[model samples]
Each structure stands twice: as C-alpha cells, then as structure tokens.
Target: MAQGAALGCLTIASLVVARWGGPAVLGEYALLRVLPWLTGVIASAGLPVASTFFLAARTGSDPRLRPTLLTLALAGSAVGLLAWAVAVPLLHRLFFPDLSPGLLLLAGLTVATQLFTVWGKACCQGQADMLGANIVIVGEELLFLPAYWLVSHAGLHGITAVVVAMVGGGAAATALSVGRLAATGFFTGRAAPSLRLAREVVVFGARAQLGNLLWLVNLRLDFLILDALAGPAVLGIYAVASKFAELMRLPATAANYVLYPRFARAERVDTDAEVRRLLPRALALTALATPVLALAATIALPLLYGQAFRGAVLPACVLLVGLAVEGASAVASAYLWGIGRPGANSFAMGLGVVVTVALDLVLIPHHGAMGAAASSSAAYLATSAVLVGLTYRFSSTGRVSTVVASRAEPL
Candidate 1:
C-alpha cells in the first residue's frame, strides 16, 4: 500500500509538471530523465537483483559478502560515470541540442546519486524490508515534487531547472536511503571484501545485469526513437499518455516487489509449484482490472491534461492492453529470477526488444505515438507468451515429479 501510494503521488506529481510546464517542457523533462535513468540501471550491474537473491538466501551474513557487493557496486558506478562523461557531448548534440553543457554535467550527478540510492534500496529489499525499500523508492519522487516547485517558483524554468531539481532530490534520497540502511544495521557485519566473492557476484550480476539492461532498453528505447523521429511536442504527449497506461501496472509492480523475495525463498523448496499457483491469480486480477483502468484513463486523462493531450487517449488505451499482458510477464519474470534463471529472463526481454525496435522502426515514422504503442503492446504480448510457456513447462514437470515421487513412496 505504501508503494502504491508512492506511485500514485508520482503520477500526480507528473501531471502537475505537465500542467505547469506544458507539453514542450514536459517533453524536455522526459528526455533529460532518460539518460540518468539508463546510466543508473547500467551502473547497478544487476547487483541489486543479485543482492535480493543473495540476501534473501542469508548470504549477507557471510563476512566477505557485504564488502564484496559494496566494492562491485562502487566499481559499477565508476564505470557508469565514465561512460556518461564520454556520452554526454554526443547526447547533447543528438537529443537536447539547446541545453547547456553545465546542465548536462549536473544531470550526471543525479545519475551518480541515483545509483547509490538504488544500491541502498536493494540492500533493504534483500533483507525483506519492503517498507524500507519502498521508502527509498518513493522518497526520491516525493522530494522531487517539492524541489521542483521550489526551483520553478524561483523563476527558473525549462530543462535546466528540471535537471537541477532532480539532482537535489536524488542527493537527498540517496543520503536518506544510506542512512536508513545503516540504521537498519545492514552494514554492521564484520565483512571484508574478498576476491572470490567479488568474482562470484560479478558472474551472477553479469547475467542479471544483462537481463535488466535489456529490459530497461525495451522500456525506454521507444522514448529515444520517438524523440528522434517526432519532436518534443509529440514525444511529450506520448510520454504523458504512456504514463497513464503505466499506472495499470502498479499492482503488478508492487506484487513483484514482495513476490521477488517470496519467490526467492520458495526456490529452496519448489519454485515451480509456487509460480504455478501465484502467477495465474496475479494475471487474472490484472486482466480483470485493466479494462476498468483503461476506461477511467480515457475519461480522466483528457479532463486532467486538457484537450491538448487528447491525442494521448488512443495510445494510452493501447498501452493499457499491453501493460495487462506485461503484468503476467512480470510475475513470471520474478519467478524466473527468484529461481536463479537470469539468463532466461534476459532472453525473453531481448526478444521483446527486438520486436519493439523492429516495429518502432517500421511504424513510428508514419504512425507516431500510435505506432509506438502498437510496437510496445506487441512486444509485451510476445514476451509474456514466451515466459508463460516456460513457466508452465517447468511447473507441469514439477507437479508430475511430485505426484510420481508421492506414489513411489511406501504407504
């Protein structure tokens, strides 16, 4: 519920930004956020998810585990920072042609802070502290609302002000999250970094990171494509529309938050049975709720965003359908990850990315937001189909084995 409320606040804050700044400004803000987010994801090196697996499995108690994870996290951040430094100039030229280099540099700081914040939250999540984990997740956005208001009210406007506010909020959230982790005694262990542990973490994190990276790409690449093919105004409208569609997935998102750890623990027993039992219920609930959400969005979005955003309606509806499909996929993905099948998750998302990119390339130039919507929906459906099949196969085999084992045992 806390996570859900936080997501709601975020949606409201985004609406406030759109209303205050207008579409072009909103478009620029959306564009600016992409790089920092992508950078943070890359820098995480999939360790966040790996942390959840390891910590849930109680590996954090290992004297060497925590320090090794910390070292790897720092190393990943350094690599991301270096990559950002090299990419900024080209990115500025390509995306934000009018923004100053100083502002872009500030955005880099936001990325750095975000990486640390994600690491902190992952630590909390691994301990099965959802409240603490969510506080970190939501705190940044909560702080951003106030920070954005202050910055905008100070007579600063446009991308510069937006980026500055983001940096401030990110810094505060990172600090708070670190403090929270420390307070929880997450760092109290007598751990020292070890080469062997680090290598294991890297190997595990690499597979997870690759899957996470591909997933991020699948989610965010459309923004880049849209911005390149269409202008800020169009991208802005689509961004808002898509955000509305994204709300439909909040239940799934929250479910996965709790489910990942649960599934991770269940893996020690029989994950296939757990997946079979949990996934269908999640999918059914999501499937039932999505049309209602779509209806509400269709009526409410135009009213909230004004007719200037009416263009977003169809795409939003399209995306709602897609997100419904994604809800099922998310549950399956969590099960896969919980069972230590990062490679399979990565393969599924990679296929989705391929579909998304191909469709976006073929359709966005002519159809714009609608084309992007179609591509995303199709990709999600395809990914969900593949994952569902895999989960079913595994779960069915597990069920059969359990029955056979039961029958063979002396009565």
Candidate 2:
C-alpha cells in the first residue's frame, strides 16, 4: 500500500507533464527515460537480484558481504557513468535525434544515482527487513513531488525540469537507501573486495539479467515502434494508457521486491511449494484489481490527465488482459531467478519479445495504440504461460531438489 501510494506520487509528475506539455511532449519525455533506465539496469550487473540472493542466503554468516557488495556497487556506478558518457552521443544521434542532446546528457546522473539507490534497497531486503525496504521505497518516491515543486519554482520546466527532478528524486533515494543500509552497520566491519566474489556476482547478474533486460525492453519497445510509425502525440496517449494498465502490476512489484530474496534463501529446501503458495494469491490480486482500476480510470483519466487523455481508456482496458497475466509471470520469474534457473525466464522472455516485435510490426501501422495494447497482451500471456508451465514441470518432476547448493556459489 505504501509502495502503491508512493508510485501515485511519481505519477503526479507524469500528470504535470501531460497537462502542461500534452501528449507529444509527454511522449518525447518518455523516450528520454528508456536509455537511462536501460543503462541503469545494465550498470547494476544484476546486483539488486544478486544482492538479495547472497544477502538473504547468508544473512548473519558474512559481515563482509554487505560492505563488499557496497564497494562493487560504487565501482559499477562509476563504470556506468563512463559507459553512458561514451554511448549518449551515439544513442542521441540514432534514437533521440528529434530531442536535445543536452537533456539526454543531463539525465545520465540518474544512471549512477538509481543504481546505488536500488542496490541499497535490495541489500536491506536481503535481511528480510521489509520495514526498512518499504521505508526506502516509499521515502524515495514520495520526495518526487516536493523536488519537482522546488525545481519548477526555480525556473526549470518541461522535460528539462522533469529530468532534473528525476535526478533530485534519485539523489534523495540514494541518501535514504544508503543511510538505511548504514544503520545496519554495513561499513563498521573490516571488508575487502574479493575478485572471486565479484566474478560470481557478475556471472549471476548476467544470467539473471537476461530475462530482466528482455522484460524491460518488452515493456518499452512498443513505445519506440509506435513513435516511429505514428507520432509523439499518439505515443503520449499510449503512454498514459500504459501507466494505468501497469497499476495492476503492483502485485507483481510486491512479489519481485519482497518475495524474490525469500525464494533465494529457501531454494535449498523447496521453491515449488513457494511458487504454488504465492502464484494463486498474486494472480487473484490482479484479477480482482484490474476491473476495479479500469472502472476507476474510466471516470478518472479525463479529470486527472485531462480530456485529451480520454482516448487512453480503451487501450488501458485492452492492456489489463496481458497485465493480469504478467502478474503470474512476475512470480514465476522470481522463482526461476531465486532458484538459479534464470535461463528458463530468459527463454520465455525471448519468446515474448519475438511475439511483441511481430505483432507491433503488423498491428501498430493499422491500429496504432490499440495494436500496441493487443501485442503487449499477447506477448505477456505468452511469457506467463511458459513460466507457469515450467514451474508446474518442476513441481511434478522434483527437478528442484537436484539443484545442489554449493558453499561458494550458492546461486
């Protein structure tokens, strides 16, 4: 609930953008986000997932683990910033030629800030510290409005202001996350950076990120295609619809943020039962929430995002089908990653991407936003089916027991 409300605050920034800039400007702003967000994920080297895994599995055994992970996160952020410096020029030329290079370059700050922020939160969750994790999550997003308010008053507006506000929010989150992590005395003990541990983290992170990267792109690829074939105005309407549709995914976010580490910690005994136990609850939450949220949005979309955004309602309704399915998929993915079978998720997400591209190619030209919605729904269901099928297979075959946990590479 706190997380959901915090996201609501973040959405207020979008509302401001939509109201002031309309759909075209809004669409452009969304485009600005794709690169930094993608880069941030790349920069993490999957540390958030890996942190939760290693931290939870060895909760009290290793004091050095927290500090070691912290050191690596700092180093990774530096590398990410350097990489962003190199790539932003080319990326701006290719993908965002219509937008300003200066704005894109400025948004690079988010890559480093967001990486450290997420790593800290993931580290907190590693110890089953839900209160601390939730505090960090809520604290970060809740500050978005105040930061935007301050920056807007200081003569920053439009996408530039939003970008700056995002950096501010990220910085705030970094302070909160790192501060909370420190409260646990992460830096008080003697620690050294272990290359062996670093290699293991990178490898695990790479494997875990395969599906994650695919999933992230799957969420955003349609926006690019829609923008190309249609216009920014059309993409903006679609973006509003996408945001509303994703509200149903709060359950998935909860599972990913909280349950993933638990799965990692308990994988030695049984992941199948956890899957069976949580899958139904998460799926049911989506089923119940989608229609209610859709109904609410029908009345609220125009009032909140303005009448220009009324067109988003139909598309949002269409997207609910796939999002409901994605709820199940998220839990299944957590199970796969937690149990070190991330290849299963990679295979599923890869298949979903193919479906997404093929459908976007065929549908967007004809149907526009509705086409994107349909494509997203079909692709989501495709990924969900595969994940659920794999979990069931493992359940029946006792394959999970074969995954012998090693002391060094626990998974």
Candidate 3:
C-alpha cells in the first residue's frame, strides 16, 4: 500500500507537470535528474542491498551491525556529494544541454538525503520492520508532493523547481527516517565501521552493485539516447509512457521488499525452493496486472495529460509485456543476489544492456518513442528469458515442471 501510494504521488506530480508545462518541460525535468541519480547509484555502492543482507545474515548475533550500516550510508553519501560536485563541469552540458552546473549541487543534496532513507529502509528490512520501511516510502513521496505543489504554484519552472522540491522532500524524509532509526535503537551502540566489515560489504556489495549498475543502465540508457537523438520534447512524451508502464512492476518491487531480507537469512542450498514458491506468484501477479494497467493508461493518458500526451498510450501499451517480463527478471535477480551470485545477475542484465543500446540506436531515429518502447520491451524479454533460464539451471531439479511435479502442492 505504501509503495502504491508512492507511485500515486509520482503520477500526480507528473500530471501536474504535464498539465502545467507540457512534454518539453517534463522532458527537461527528466534529463536534469539523471546526473544525481546516476551518481547516487555509484556512491551507494550497493549498501542498501548489502546492509540488509549482512544485517539479516547476522541474525542479530552482531550488535554492531546496525550502526555499521549507518556509518556506511554516511560515508557513501558524502562521497556521492563530492563526486556530483566534481562531475558538474564535465557532464552538465553533454547530458543536460543548457542547464547551469550549479543545479547539480541541489541535485546532489537531494540524492544525499535520499541515501539516508534508502539505508534506513534497508536497516528496517533487515530487522523485519516492514512498517518502518513503508513509512520511509510514504514520508518521502507525501512530503515531496506538497513541496512540488508549492514550487509549481509559485511559477517556478524546469530543473530548479523539480530539484529544489526534491531537496525539500528529501531533507524532511531523511529527518523522519533518521528519527525513526534512532528511536528504535538502531543507533544504540557506538559501533564504528571496521575495515573488516567495510571489506565484507565492499566485496559482497561490489558484485551486487555491478549487477545493480548494469540494471540501472539497462533501464535508463534509452532515456539518455532518446534525449540526445529525439531531444527533450520527444523524450518527455516517452517518459510519460514509461512511467505508466511501471505499473506492471509494482508486484515484483513489493515482493523484493520482503523477499530480499527473507532470502538473505536462508541457506543458499534451499533457496531454490523459495524461488519456486515465490517466483510463480510474482509472475502471475505481474501478468494479471499488466493488461489492466494498460487499459487504465489508455483511458487516463488523455484524461490526465490532455490530448498532447495521448501519444503515450501506444508506447505504454507496447511496454507492458516487456515490463512484465522485466518484473519477473527483477525477482529472479533478487534470488541470485540473495544466494550470493550477483555476478550471474550481472551477466544477464549486461546482455539486455547490449540489446537495449543496439535496438534503441537502430529504432529511435525513425520511430522515435514507439521504437524505443519496442526496443525496451525486447531487451527486457531477453533479460528475463536468460534470467529464468539461469534460475532453472541453478535449481537442483533442472526443470521447473519436474520440481512442481515432485511436490504434491500446486505452484
């Protein structure tokens, strides 16, 4: 429900942007965000995944684990802020075109605050405090919405408005998450981060982060390409379509929220059974939801974004199957990560990335957003197919049907 609400908030904000500024402005907003977002991905170093995994794996045996996560988040965010500042001179023009380099500072601060929420949620997941995790999501989205409202109503436009509002939301959300963490005794002990622990997180996190970074690129590479080849106005239209397509992902995203910590605590040997039980459910939900989401998007695109954005309808519909498959791919990726084989996950996403780049390059010139959607869908299908194959190979029974038949229960 919290995740749903967060998506709802995002949709509302997008609507406001589309209704107020049109696709060109929205496109600019999207492009402006990529820099800090990419930086955060690198700076995070997979700590969100690693912190949850290690903390849960410890089974509360290590009193210092909680504080160590805090330390890691702090150090990571600081590094990210510095990197974002440094990269401004070189990258702003290439990616953002005419935008000022100074805006990256605001973007960096927003992402830094977001890192705290990310770590806080990871810590909660490690502790199985699902409520806390949900609160973190809720607080950020809800707070950001009003900030965005204020900025928009004030007649602020473009990168400055979007990022300033993001900073407002992020800072407030960080305070909420940090206070929650402290109140819950997550910072109870004075556990300074040790080199051994840092190394452990780094070794494990680097592998997971590689897959994460690849997945991130696979997901967003088209946005950059679209911005470059088609320009921001076209990219803006595509962004709406992509956002609508994200509905198919909710089930898998929610599943991973619970599954990662649960899987991390289990032994690798029987992780296959866990996958069998959960993977089918996740895929089923994604499949069932996709067409419904497609239908809603078809109806809502014109209603919410006006006739100009009706073009997004086709592109969004095109993304459903691909995004559904991508949803399943994510669940499978979580399984691999939980079992300490993030390297395998990287292999699958890397192939998808190659496909994404090639097809996007080939398609975007002629067909624009439609071509990009088709390419994205194909790449997602490819990624999921390979990932599913990996899942089957890793499972001892070698066949999904065989395993289901071996059990008396229905999948």
Candidate 4:
C-alpha cells in the first residue's frame, strides 16, 4: 500500500513537472537522467540483489554482514563516481549538448546519492523490513515533488530546476535511508564481516551485476536511441508517453517488493509452491489493470500535458501493452534471481535487448515515436515469453516431484 501510494505520488509529480515546463523541459530532464541512472545501476554492481539474497539467507546467523555489505557498496559508489566523470563528457556531447558544467556536476551528485539510496534499500530488503524498504523506494520522489514545485513556483524553470530538485531529493532520501538503517541497529555491534563471506558476496555480486546491467540497458537504451535518431522534441513526447506506460508497472513493482524476500526464503526450503501460487494472481491483476490504465491515460494525458502531448496517447497505449507483459515477467525474473539463476535471467534480457536494438534501428528513423513504441513492446513480449518458459521449466520438475511424493505417501 505504501509503495503504491508513493509510486502514484511520483507519477503525479512527474505530470506536474510536465505541465509546468512542457515538452522541451521534460525531454531534457528525461535525457539528463539517462547517464546518472545507468551509471548508478552499473555502480551498484548488482549488490542490491546480492545483498537481498545473501543477507536474507544469513541475517539470522550473521548480523555483521550488514555493515560489510554496506562497506562494499560504498566502495562501489566511489568507483561509480569515477565512471561518471569519464562518461559524462561523451554523454553530454551526444545527448545533452546544452547542459552546463555545473549541471553536469549536479548530475554526478545524483548518481552518488542514488548509489547510497540503492545500498540502503537493499539492506532493508535483505532484512525483510518491507516498510523501511518502501520508504527508501518512495522517499526521493516525495522530496522531489515538493522541491520541484517550489523551484518552479519561484521562477526557476527548465533543466536547471529539475536537476537541482533531483539532486536535493536524492540527497534527502539517501540520508533518510541511512538513518533508518542505523536506527534499526544495522550498523551496530562489534562482530565484523568475515573474509570468506566478503568473497562470497563479491562473487555473487559480480554475476548479479551483469544481469542487472543488462536489464537496465533493456529498459533505458531506448531513450538514447530515440534521442539520436529523432532529436529532443520527439524524444520528449515519447518520454512522457513512456512515463504513463510505466504506471502500468506499479502493481508488479509492489508485488515484487514483497515477493522477492518470500522467494528468497522459499529457495532456502527448496519449495516454489508459494511463488507458483502467487504469480498467476499477480499477473492476472496486472493484465486486467493495463487496459483500464490505458483508458485513464488516454483521457488524462491530454488534460495533464495539454494538446502538445496528444501524440503521446497512442504510444502510451502501445507501451502499456509491453508494461503489462513485463509485469508478469518481472515476477518470473525475481524468482529466477532468488533461486540463484541470474545467468538465465541475464540471457533472457540479452535476447530482448537484441530484439529491441534490431527493431529500433530499423523502425525509429522511419516511424519515429510509434516505431520506438513498437520495438519496445515487441522486445518485452519476446523477453516475457522467454522468462516465463525458463521459470516454469526450472520450477516444474521440483513441483512434479513434490506432488508425486505426496501422492505416494500413505494416507
């Protein structure tokens, strides 16, 4: 519930920004986000998933692992900062030529703060503190909306205000997350993390990181592709449409927050019955919600964004189809990761990225925003099919064995 409300607020906040600043500003904000978000995902090195899996498994026996995981994440953030420095100039020249050095520096800060936020949320998730985890997830947008509104009202418009608001919100959220962890005694006690455990985490994190990086690429690479081929104006329109499409994902996001921990614990017991039971209902709900959301968005988008964004309607609807497929796929992917099959998950995402890139290259130049939408939706459908098949194959044999054992037992 908290996660849903927070995500809803985020959607509203984004709409507010769009209404206040229009397409160019919204497009620039979306473009500026690409590098930092991508860099932060890379910098985290899959520690979020690694931490959740390892920590959930070990939290009962090794409380000290929290600080160790955090220490490793902090080191990863420093490395991520260095990466941002190298990537920023190239990214700026290619996508954000008008951005000033100061704005770029602020973008770097966003990446650093986001790393901290990711680490903190990972810790809460590892501990199975759902409330704390949701807070961390939602905190930034809560802060960002108010800051954005204040700045815009105070006559600061365009990318400058958006970047400042982003940085401020990120800093605030990171602090709150860290504070929540400290308050819960995550950083307390004298027992230190072991070298063996550290090595295990690093090894797991490396594998998980690759999968995560690929997954992010599948999600965000479209922005860059669109910007290069269609320019900012078209990209901005598509970005707005994409945001509405993303709302279709809220149910899946909420489900995964609770499901990942449950899946992790279930993996320990070698039982997937719980996951199997819950997945269909989650997917059904998401499937049912998508068209309703599409209807609402069709009506609301024009009102919220004005007629300048009327073109976003069809694209948003198309992307919602993909998001709906992605909702179910997300649950399956989480199950795969929880069961320590990130390699398989990565392969699925890689296949999807290939599909997306192939289609985007052919389609974006000719069809523009609609082509981008079609490419993303097709890729999502293909990837979802692969993941669903992989997940069922992996879990079905165990399920059959369990069923046979139960049937054969004396009753």
Candidate 4: misplaced stretches above 4 Å? 153-155, 267-270, 398-411
**lDDT for residue 308 in candidate 4, whole number 0-100:** 90
Please, what are the lDDT tens digits per residue for candidate 2 over residues 135-203? Answer: 888877777678878888999877777778878888898999988878877667776666777777777
Best-fitting candidate, measured by lDDT?
2
Q: Tell how far residue 168 is off in model 1, in angstroms.
A: 0.2
Which of 1 and 2 is the better model by lDDT? 2
Q: Which portions of model 1 miss their true places by more than 4 Å? A: 398-411
Ranking by lDDT: 2, 1, 3, 4
How close to the true structure is residue 116 of candidate 1, measured as C-alpha lDDT? 81
The C-alpha lDDT values of all candidates are 0.78, 0.79, 0.77, 0.76
What is candidate 4's lDDT per residue for 120-143, written digit by digit as tens?
Answer: 888788788878888887885688
Candidate 2 has an lDDT of 0.79
1-411: candidate 1 lDDT, tens digit per residue: 666777776777678778887887788888666777678666766777777777776455576777787787788778878888888899888888777777787788877787888888888888878778888888966888888889988988877778888888888988988888888877777767888767666666778778788777777778889988897889889998888888777888877777777776663347676777888788887788888988888798889989999999999888877778766787888877776667778888889889998999998999999999999888888888888877676568643323222110110
- Tens digits of per-residue lDDT, candidate 3, 1-411, equal 988998898788777777767787788776655556557657868887777777776534566566666677888888888887887777676666656777765667866887787778777877888888899878877787788888878988766677778888788888988887787788877666566667677667777778777777777788888888888888889999998998777777888777877766775556778787766777777888888888898899888888888899999999997987655676788777666667788889889899998998899889999999998999888889888878767765644223222111111
**Candidate 3 Cα outliers beyond 4 Å, as residue runs:** 32-34, 153-155, 397-411
Cα lDDT, model 1, residue 183: 86
